[model samples]
Target: MIQKLQKKLEGKLPGIESWKRMAVKSGKGESIESESLQKYSDWISKDKLNDMRKAAVLIGLFKKNDEWCFSLIRRPMNEKNHPGQIALPGGAREKNENLMNTALREAFEEVGIKPEDVQIIGQLTPIPVPVSEYLIYPFVGVIDYEPEWVINEDEVEELFILRMSELISSDNGYTETWDLRGNKVEVPIFKVMNETVWGATAAVLSELIDIAK
Candidate 1:
């Protein structure tokens, strides 16, 4: 199963065009909206998306114990933004860097995956975060072998490994109401590794799940 999944992913990634189509079907604006995170989309009307700071994150895949799996990180509670939130491995795009390079560099820095070891398959649609004012680009990549994770303590609280099967399973996706900034809002979330994954990270993963199916 692992090998087959690897081949399907590495053999022919759906790339940007597919992502654009999927974006229309399952991106932030379509599938990931919530009352609390709605502020993250408010910037759309300002026509200043290009002016937002750029960032990137990686959806990394690998085989573990004969099953196909992916990775996510829990941010440290003391961090300034999205502290203690579940997120993909990535960060701000540095000067003179493209989105792909930014994703690779940030993944290496936050999760200790060597850049050369990652085989980038394709990227998903870029989404905007109104709260942080960042335009985030998400890339999907695979490593042939299991990685030796050297987590950065300052940035990542711990790592979460989720099987693709679990992510795509209908049983794992559900909604719950939560108090956000004093307003009660219904949030769509995924149950992974016993953690509640919502917001932008969940939004990006939602697109990947649709593509895998």
Candidate 2:
């Protein structure tokens, strides 16, 4: 599965335009984001979004239990934003750092993955997150085997190494109504490790799934 994904990634990526087609519909042609997007319209526009702070995340795939798997981290509950949320290992760009380096460095810090061990396949579309004011660039990488995860407790509460097949399964995807800020909206989510995966993280995985397909 990882080899298949690597080959697909070598060519054209689905990008955010493909994400719109795949992520927007909740199996009923109803958009999960229309309401919240309008609320953030002032900054969510293409021009304004390009000016937002940049961040990057790594979808680190490895072999486990004879299957292809990847990593996700649960943030500490005390985090100022997105507390307790599950995410790919990543953070905001640092001074003089390129986005890919930002992803590699942050992964090493958050989950103890050696940058030298991870062979990057390529990058996926950048997902604009209006609420956090970040344009998140995602890169897919592979390691031969899973490492002994040394979680940075200050940033990561837990690390989950989940099967890529689980991600590729359609049964994990669903939508539910959630109150964002003050408005209730239908939120598309993926149930992974019995935890909710949504927002920009979900957007990244959605495209990865499309690429693998």
lDDT for each of the candidates? 0.74, 0.80
Candidate 1 TM-score over all chains jointly: 0.79
Give candidate 2 regions above 4 Å deviation: 21-50, 170-173
| Predicted model with the maximum TM-score | 2
Worst 10 residues of 1 by lDDT: 19-28
Q: What is the lDDT of residue 22 in candidate 1?
A: 20
Query: For model 2, what is the alpha-carbon lDDT of residue 40?
Result: 40
Per residue, candidate 1 scores C-alpha lDDT tens digits across 1-213 of 434444555454443323232221122234333332344445545665678799999988888988878789999999876989999999999997998999999889988888899888777767776568788988888888878998999889999889988888833437676666665556667787889887778767776775677
For model 1, state the Cα shift of residue 43 in Å.
Answer: 9.2
Clashing pairs in 2: none
